[model samples]
Target: MLWFPTLSKSGFRSFIADNDEGSTGKWMVPIPVPDIGLIWEEIEDAAVEGRILAAKKSTHELVRIIGHNLACVYCSASDPDTVAETLRTLREIGVDGELKYKSDLATFDGREEYLYSSSEFETLLPRP
Candidate 1:
């Protein structure tokens, strides 16, 4: 299955460096957006129901990607203890104002930090 390159080449290079252990296979493979789009349905599971609205931090001068992908929201939900909770969880995750977070380097720091960095004895300052 194809996945979007959500980071820049150099950015992705760094991502590969930092994430080498978690993944395996070719370290670098660049594909154009149109080419990647060819396998959209397979990667995102497009076709069962509602479309997929991806909120990834874009690369290649793009923003969020909307695909025809659909999944059993029940299957993808994190805390799917009950039918109703599972159904409503992701269905309204975007509009409900419920914030879920993951531990990534950038998220740990403010957005401003990701754009610039300084290593003057381990202190990072704002670039304003």
Candidate 2:
């Protein structure tokens, strides 16, 4: 899933609540955006195209359009080829950023669950 650094902790929690289907076994695979920031126009365009692809190719909804920076894609039941195509389009538009991954704990349903960490996500700098 694509996650914007600007999202507050509450906002992030809200996103999880909205997207999760009460599945305790789920993991948050957050792909962070680096400090260079994204090309918003390109991202918006890609999201529209992705939505179109999801409509024809996915059994479940894939694209979640919040804004240029807040969009998320739920790829659980989507076609890999379509996801690849969307990624390729991002690369073609020079929308590149380093993705960070970390594991942390969160509470869901009164039970502790593992969630990929997003600490310092907004401070990520481009690799030198």
Which candidate gets the maximum lDDT versus the true structure?
A: 2
Backbone clashes for every candidate come to 1, 0
lDDT of 1 by residue, 20-82 (tens): 122111101122345444332332232223232122222433322433221211111111122
**What does candidate 2's lDDT look like per residue over 1-107, in tens digits?**
33333212122222223223322121122222432554544454544554312111111123234212223322222223333443444445554553222111123
Clashing pairs in 1: 46-69
TM-scores for the candidates: 0.20, 0.31
Candidate 2: stretches off by over 4 Å: 1-38, 48-69, 73-77, 99-128
What is the TM-score of candidate 1?
0.20
- For candidate 1, what is the lDDT? 0.25
Q: Tell me, by TM-score, which candidate is best.
A: 2
